[model samples]
Target: MSAESRPAIDGRIAELDDGQRRLLFDRRVGDAGEVADATRALLALVRSEGDDALFDFARRFDGVELDALEVPREKWGEALESLDSEVIDALTRAARNIETFHRAQLPSDVEVEVEPGVTLGRVFVPLEAVGVYAPGGRAAYPSSVLMGVVPARAAGVKEIVVCSPPGPDGMPSPVVLAAAAIGGATRLFAVGGAGAIGALAFGTGSIPRCAAVVGPGNRWVLEAKQQVAGEVIIDSPAGPSEVLVVAEEGCAQPAWLAAELIAQAEHDPDAAVAFVTTSPSLLEAVRRELRIGVAATPRREVVAEALSTRGALLLAADHDEMMTFAEAYAGEHVVLCTRDPRADRAGMRTPGTVFLGGASSVAFGDYMTGANHVLPTAGTARSFSGLSALDFLRSYTWQELTAEGAAGMAGPVATLAEAEGLPGHATAARLRGSKAGEETS
Candidate 1:
């Protein structure tokens, strides 16, 4: 939680038994009070100063000058058309896969007659428009774009808008534009951080307001979402990314497991990548794999910072202990690299997502595994979920009643309204009752 702790570092790997390591992650997974002041200051700027504040933060954090926060529509076509055919093809394939999965999640209208003559129905309607934030922190994020926007499209939202921070050169990345286009984003923007969230929340000159915002960023983004959530709906106040790997006796290769852990840690300095196991030999093997694999990463400093801060090699007494630890951690992404993730999912209840088996790695779920990757992070998996098509739609209930049905229910309706001490409501109910009684008489 110290200011000294937030900066980047490749964490030192030590040979700690599972008990000691599990204890370390348990403490690190919760809120770090030290960052509260920093997050609060950033949010205040977004609320009062608006666009001006965003530009300043853009300049300060991302080192990019911003003439405009909104990316023109024409650029979307240009990016989609200009990208290499091969890369586009890959994204197209992934899009179809992701879309197919999400489309299946769409809920249809339901009609039911709960009473003898009363008919009640439910309808699912897409939101008017939505904004999705894809963080380009320390790297490009085409995958984030696909993950954020595609599901909104699948839910049939009309206007899907996206925002990501500009580069040091003051321009959005071509890959982000291209991916969003494939996922059916109607517009794109250069906005990033809390100011971007504010624009989406309150509307600005260029960035039109959105009904809801979905994506993951630093604590600033998370805090911004919380501050403006009352004005507009937000998917969840996403925090740092995390992954908890539950390793069984027949878990995958230790090196491969380490790669999965490393993939999660690179998202942010607060990223938590951990493994809970019952075998000391497996724990040692995972360490060796982490050492060798981490050496090859360009983002080794970022991964190391995460590991030292939150990464753990928990040694559990048994499977029950592993489950207990995993549920308590409530990881954003739970990877069961064991022989059977399906069986494991039945017992684990806290992850935003469960990736079963080695073949279904967290990266697969992050990209083309057909499951959404924009999941709740920090320890919020206890009460959060990943982004989905359902997040972009609102459902409403409709009811109708025949004259006879209305007459039959008017007395009860009036009684209840009067009992609740609402004369206006009671009068309305009685007026209907009188009319229906007259027709019957």
Candidate 2:
């Protein structure tokens, strides 16, 4: 296909109808019919059969037979030692960067005296255990390991268990194991897909139940997390990788801009990559560059398909109109490629991490930039945040009341409860007040 004739729709911002608006704003990846059905069946199998189900799924889906569900603790040491020195060094450096960045996100224990004799505050506590899922069927995700584990570790989680698909030999990837070790994972399991999410949500014979599950995964994994959301906390619906670039006339080079979009497109056929600008000539130049870049890239087919389907190079009337379009789109990664990106940042409604200026790339944020790459996708960035140290923690709100405080609150509590038709609540408040009166007497 020629560059201009590709699937992207080029038009003015004012031309977008309700259908087109929904097409750009909606998170529905085609229809989730098949994915939901498959995910439900897999989750049921894992929940009912436990380790037996895990083994079966491993054999059926991953094409590996597992004698054991978990990789032993001693195996972690061996895996760490077996990794190449350079790989280990890179992971170590990355781990330090991740840890340092996340440590700052740890919340301080809060205490407040709201009123006389009444103390109310929130106490942050780490989850007892957490599960980190690193996708491994198509490719190894050592970066995912660090992104999930390091944040939980920094949050002071006592136990962090990692679940990844096993290879043909029924062992987790050595590089993944090395990252887990470096990131402070307490345990590792050779389980993946929806089954692994179910195993984490509902405890198996070997895989310990986790309080929360945090990581990025495919549709099946994300669906499984959604199915079992009430059973355990999840970071977000992190399904596919997406990036949107807002470039001005002389903001970025066309070749570099095309490369950035292509990099996002190479992630998956379903992944979305979009570019918005006021300059039609720049968009044309980018399309020309994409024609050459896609042909030379190894994952050209994936990039081409992605660009055709979910990708766009939209033309807006001006920067304000472009911002309005971007706010509606609410992409996973938003890049600002402008002469002064910060100047345009005045009223931008950010859905995910923002890459400022032409030099900033999403790839840098994905790797060793000390920022978590597990961000919200499919317009959920409008409501959800990327995974961080806070995801592995639960806040407990505590209130301590003295006799005077109890007496002071009783009248209002009783009045409100009576107004709300809860006589029992009113009685309970009155009883507390009566006890306080008796104690004082």
User: For residues 1-441, what per-residue lDDT tens digits would candidate 2 score against the true structure?
Assistant: 475226455566688777666766775687588999989998898888999999999889989878898898788889889988999998888889999999998899889988887899999999999999998876689999999999998999999999999999899899998898898998999999999999998998899999998788888888999989999999999997888889999988998888888988888778888888899999889878878888888887888888877777788888788888788778888888977788766566656788898888888888788989999999998889999999998998999887777777888999999999999999887877787564963
Q: Which clashing pairs does model 2 show?
A: none
Model 1 worst lDDT window (10 residues) = 4-13
Off by over 4 Å in 1: 1-50, 435-441
What TM-score do all the candidates reach, one by one?
Answer: 0.89, 0.93
Q: What are the lDDT figures for the candidates, one per model?
A: 0.77, 0.86
- lDDT for residue 52 in candidate 1, whole number 0-100: 84
Model 2 scores a C-alpha lDDT of: 0.86
